[model samples]
Target: MPDGVASVTLEYPKKISRGRYFKPAVFPSAFIKTVQVHDNVLSVAIPRGAPDAFPHRMVWRDAAGAVVHAFTDPAF
Candidate 1:
């Protein structure tokens, strides 16, 4: 993020169904801090002890709070 703003959302398994056993659970959402750099890779910093997140797109808005860019890859 150019303006130093970023976020992340994670979703865990709701339940597991195998054979004759089922475990139900819900995982809370986690947010990551946006690391900004004038030049370099743009990545979000996840909280400590966090697992890899699921595939998702990032929605970027301008300082005026208007949608500027949205994509899965910054190179886009």
Candidate 2:
């Protein structure tokens, strides 16, 4: 990872049962300067000189603000 660049990979279920669908994950706007999604890969860029913590937990939420997915780096 380079300075000002943060990335995370998201994995979705391959099989969806009836009436099940995928919802987009929402990231914190204040911490991220830009976002790019390619397949299951999600990349977020933090502004240069931004005061933030590394090895942070990334949270994904549903429309009701409930946690749908949450993860932190395993190697961290």
Candidate 3:
């Protein structure tokens, strides 16, 4: 679990066992129903396989779906 959001850290097999990060991402919100993995990021989806809406910003949500404060997207 992340400091405040509902996140899971997965360990991959290193070098050939590592991962690359993709930004411009989204997750399930009040308007969305599902969270899915797409490419290297999380994609927010609607119920029953409907089209997805673009989210301007997103961070990890707590187990209760409350947004996390510490997991803000780095302003790099």
- Give the candidate number with the greatest lDDT: 1
Better of 2 and 3 by lDDT: 2
Q: C-alpha displacement of 47 in model 3, angstroms?
A: 15
The lDDT ranking, best first, is: 1, 2, 3
Which of 1 and 3 is ahead in lDDT? 1
Model 3 superposed RMSD (Cα): 13.2
Model 2 lDDT on a 0 to 1 scale:
0.39
Q: How many clashes show up per model?
A: 0, 0, 4
Query: Per-model C-alpha lDDT, please?
Result: 0.40, 0.39, 0.34
Q: In candidate 3, where is summed lDDT lowest over 10 consecutive residues?
A: 9-18
Candidates' RMSD to native = 7.7, 16.5, 13.2
- How many angstroms is residue 67 displaced in model 2 relative to the true structure, after the best TM-score fit? 0.2
TM-scores for candidates 1 onward, in order:
0.34, 0.32, 0.25
Please write out the lDDT profile of model 2 over residues 16-70, one tens digit for every residue. Answer: 2223364433333434222333444555544323323342456554434455556
lDDT of 3 by residue, 1-76 (tens): 3344454222211112112564332334333233533333554433322222322234455567655542222331
